[model samples]
Target chain A: MLMEKSAVENGFIIDLSSIKNTSQLVFELSSIMEHPDVKGKNICLKLGSLDLKQSQLLSIKALIESMNAKIAFIDTKSEQTEASAVSLGIMIKEISSDLTADIAPSEEDFKDSEYKEEAVEERTENPVQDTNSQEIVEVHTEVHNNPIETTEGIEDIYDEVSAQELSEVIPSENYQPDGFGILAASEGLLPEETSKYILLDTGNVLPEGVEENSVNTESMQTLYINQTLRSGQTISYDGNVFIIGDAHPGSEIIAGGDITVWGILGGIAHAGCNGNITSKVRALKLNAIQLRIAGLYARRNDTLNVPYVQKTNEFTPEEALIEDGKIVIYKKLRRD
Target chain B: MTGRVIVITSGKGGVGKTTTSANIGTALAKSGYKVVLIDTDLGLRNLDLLLGLENRIVYTIVDVIEERCKLRQALVKDKKNPNLQLLAAAQTRDKTAVNAEQLKEICDTLKEENDFVLVDCPAGIEQGFQNAVAGASEAIVVTTPEMSAIRDADRIIGLLATKEEITSVKLLLNRVRPNLIKSNEMMSVDDVVGILEIPLVGIIPEDAGIITSTNKGEPIVNDENALAGKAYRNVAERILGEEVPFLDLDEPKGFMAKIKNAIAKLKVKV
Candidate 1:
């Protein structure tokens, strides 16, 4: 994922423009920092529109510093990262066009077309740069939209990266009011926490004597709970279970039918534990550590580092169900 | 040599038990000792990820207990240090898969060849914790500067008292923000030690470097200039029966300190 390694006057340029998520960026950046050539050298980071929290940016800065190297400056299109860099006293200087022109990474290296198109537009504004990048610059501007939607391919990306990064980006791009895609797969790729739930290799994690069956859950009695489920607390029902408050991590909810949580579900939710394949788990914020449906069990991805503290209060509701023997999550866009 | 098996445990979760285990284990190994770190947080393992040895794990403690793989094969060597090895916990199996007797047997075998066997116990005093403490004679109860963590650590110390095999149980206060303590916003190390009523082993400052080191899959103890790393190294020396003083956690704000830090970095580079 690290391309365009160039040595500057007294430093090295580790262009992390290709990688999208923070974890992958750090994962790759730390690996690059381990190389003897990059050690103790002033490092210039070209971060293309990756929104990072001040704490996250500070950790990146510390990671660079711990390697006995210093970050001379960073080039980013993200205001959050810029604010973070300013607060941390790290310099925010855009790599000069002349410096980048000599070792510019190809346009295809970018994962987000929205940001890549802007970078291309910058080259288009400057016609005097070089004849080499003019052709590639013209090609990027033509196809402005890149994959308007990420459909039936989340489980695909999970097949490529290692288990530590084994995750599918949440289908957030599909929440575009079912219209012209406002953003390509860019916004959904932030934070490197795409896969909210990863399938556990444990075969048939259901309790003993429970068999897989897709019964009509609507006919079953529903257990309603109003209090928040804390750690180690458990709620088990032979039918459906609906919770009005949040289910914190370490709590367990097992239902024979469907499980609906009005608040954030951050615990383990097992729907149709008695074996109803049609049973689904829905929550205002489906951040369950383990999502279980029928006999299939999927734990939260190891790298799903959701910032516990954020300014925005927006939470897109989500639903998880069994589709073709795989637990596929669908974005539940509110009609209101 | 019969290596001392020390279980790093905290009754409460998110109190940095695994982080302490990884760091102390790494620090001990760096001091020219044969160290074997065992992660017993089955189905929720993280020790491998912190050490950046996740990809190298071919088998786990479950595989060793079940005889699916020999104990020697389950030991994944660290990337930078051959003296540091890890026996990862199985991510697919729950805590019930292994019992206390089985864990003790594994620890006994591991202690014969290694100088230190650090068991990273999972949260809660359930079967997982029992299995972790089964084979250990020494314990380090890790806690943060919070009432909840201290309360849990107290309970853990009480539980460790009932074990005939456990000879020592020391408290290692983690995430001690000295500035916050100075302003009376957070608990001080003395207060924590008073409540827990255990011998002090180490006091780790809340450093942002830990977060980066965790994500990088390298322990902070590897970074010689990191204060947290230096504190962990001191903890290892204490484990080896050295009389080391605790670090002064006052936030360094002097210009002279800056020059000293810069000079230290320059020395490390050279």
Candidate 2:
């Protein structure tokens, strides 16, 4: 015996308990539509266990339409079946009413509805037109549905909608809502203690001469000398300087950053001219007549008491640093 | 043969630049090369005195530059070595008597006939020094082992590094006392070479014979038995592309051996 049929709102439901293929489903749907009570009415094919391809669903939809009756597929979880049904002007009935109600019209849903309305309007306006215009309409509808083919297309739609909503939601000129803006805003959103900790962690927050420091550090280069800087020879650089040989008494070295001498330094060494107090002057034998770090200076007499005892009165390596507003000379540690 | 013009200069006075020039020129002449020594000191020429050609100078380099005499006429022949000659400086004329261009012209003309032209530069880095160095293609900086002399030598080396035609600059450490160097009282040859940062051409030991040789108006290079003479000869041979080891001035002498023997006897008695 054939499977029993049931009644639904404005439609008849034909159970596919015994149907195995598209031909059998079509036969059962045709018989149900042929009934006088169901003739010219909408029908819902309730799937039991049968799974059908898009082509099969489309053919069944066409057959039901030829009998002057509308057709739809109930309990269809496959998206391809639903797409083919929609392309053939067939309806899809959701298995649960709550699920149908939960999916309210989103922005993309509204766009799809508008696109369908435009497609219907064009179809009705150009009915019985030439094949060329028919193909043009098909191309137009394909272009409209092109985004539904890939996952990136869905993200593109979401991004466009969120960008538009952001422009409308945030009325402040300072509050930009793009990725970079969000990143910048996050820094401001952090708590005061947290921001302070981050600043300390980076160790880039220098003192008052930040502009000069950054400019000097960015463009500064090192000058290397492999030979001695004799008396009456002066070398001035905008950055760190290194000399591999002795600097005699009358020689002079001026730099913006640290100055390092691998040999004796008995001349005048001036470093940190860009107001960087942290810059230092290091030498194998630091006996400079005058040493200047930033604006502070130290003469030879001022450094005479600094004990640089290495191998009993021989020249010991020393480093000069600006500390507490005065230049201080100290014996350089082994690691330094 | 085109000759190499070498300038012998010591930035400080009395560092034996004239003596080094005369000895090197004489040694080269003794090796059968025609070498002419030019005194660029102008008013204070001493190369003639060191070369024992002081009484024979009828025309000075100043007269040659002034167009008063031909360069060949101003060149005085060495009585001891015919291949060696001396172009003395004018005692009355100052350093301004000849400029750098005039000296270079004279050197270029002299180099055509001579195998070597050694210019004895004046003391300071003034016009005289400039006139001496302007004609040379190579430089030999003579310096004593004193700190003051080494400082001046360093300055001169720095200046010579700026010259385009000076392809080589070598150092000659003069009057190095090995005993004093061992006691750390005087600078060693290494100390001067370290500060000057120039290749060492020679090291002349502090010998008492140098004083007698200078007083007798004879270059010490003519004294074959003298230690300073052998040092100058080695320097000349090295300048002529011959490799000669430096003399071991710190070798155990008779006095050191005597002291060592006395110490050994005292140790035995103890």
Indicate which candidate wins on TM-score: 1
Q: Please report how far candidate 1 places residue B19 from its true position, in Å.
A: 5.0
> Tens digit of lDDT per residue, candidate 2, span A181-232?
1111112333221110111111222224543232444346888999998755
Give TM-scores for every candidate, taking all chains together and pairing residue i with residue i: 0.51, 0.42
Please provide, for model 1 over A1-336, each residue's C-alpha lDDT reduced to its tens digit, 9 standing for 90 to 100.
011242223355677776789878877676566544455556778899999876577567656765756666688999999976654445566776566555444433333455356445645765553442233223222221222233333433332322111111222333333422111111123332344455655566565776778789999999999999976578999999999999876577999999999888877788998889999998888777678899887765444433231222656567788877878776643233
The stretch of ten residues in a row with the least summed lDDT in candidate 1 chain A is A161-170
Kindly provide the TM-score of model 1 when superposed on the true structure, using C-alpha atoms. 0.51
Candidate 2 residue pairs in backbone clash: none
How much is A17 displaced in model 1, in angstroms? 8.0
Q: At residue B266, what lDDT does model 1 achieve? A: 10
Question: Which candidate ranks first by DockQ, i.e. highest?
Answer: 1
lDDT scores in order: 0.73, 0.65
Provide backbone clash counts, one per model: 1, 0
DockQ (0 to 1) for model 1? 0.09
Query: Which residue pairs clash in candidate 1?
Result: A213-A275
